[model samples]
Target: MSENRRAEVDAALADVDFEKFNYQVVFETTKGTIKMDLYPDVAPGHCKNIIGLTKIGFYDGIIFHRVIPDFVVQVGCPQGSGTGGPGYTIDAEFNNLPHETGILSMARTNDPNSAGSQFFICLGRVPHLDNQYTVFGKTSDAESEAVVLSIGDVETNHSDRPLEDVKITGSEVIVTEK
Candidate 1:
């Protein structure tokens, strides 16, 4: 890591207050349940947007349209294609969070502000995505990590779409007691 990048990561880690700004995202998928711990202090806008969307059942029935072995599994587009959103766009909350295994980040086009409801989970370490995507959360436990791996390991086609559809049966924001 470059000095500047390491500094930014250190700062982000220091800024995160687990006692207050922490949140839990529970994604009940057709395969299994995947849960993550969200860090609002690092990417507040993106975190808030996802939590807001989850409250209204926005992700229910949404399919993981893109899945790549050893890369990422993506979802959150209402259209089930990669081009859908919540009829609005949120500003990019780029941070120093690394795209390591189990990390969840916003999926955007080349344009930073284009990130809407689409997001992805990293199956392995992807340093190239560091500071480029808004990483808001990560798998919080062994069970969630296992589920993420299972989803990422599924078979996919040439376009990285899974042969069988993996749907998000439900999504919820879990408030943990501090």
Candidate 2:
């Protein structure tokens, strides 16, 4: 991401009133649209990072680089591989959120604070991730949840890359009165 774009994202995030407004990110993917509700109260920084990135068109055309059956469907890697990010990182905000199906969490390296733009939506209960990853959001409705689960069921090679490309065609941030 460009420095100017990052600055614009920061400026926009600063104006948000989390207490009075609800934030959502609607992702248009090759499979279907998945709308996720952000939990700013539990993981404010993670929520802001995703919302900011979306507003800057950072997720457009990104592919779901990693998918594991009964696990997670990961995306937001600009390189269309699991090794890329938004050129910067955010500190972790681990909370008590359970890593159940439809839950959204940040993907990071061993360092908890290394999360950047990569994230995953759970396809089943992942108890090992509870309070380990930064859980910031979840599928907002049943339809969205179904889409995420379906994405997770896609066939992958040895590296977990989808046999067929599953790209995020576009993304949008939705803010509504709380």
Clashing pairs in 1: none
Clashing pairs in 2: none
TM-score of 1: 0.87
User: Looking at model 1, which ten-residue stretch has the lowest summed lDDT?
Assistant: 1-10
Clashes of each: 0, 0
What ranges in model 2 sit over 4 Å off? 1-5
**Backbone clashes, candidate 1:** 0
Model 2 earns a TM-score of 0.95
**CA lDDT of each candidate?**
0.82, 0.91
Model 1 accuracy (lDDT, Cα) = 0.82
Please provide, for model 1 over 74-136, each residue's C-alpha lDDT reduced to its tens digit, 9 standing for 90 to 100. Answer: 998777778777766778988887899999999998998888788999999999999888999
Error of 2 at 174 (Å): 0.8
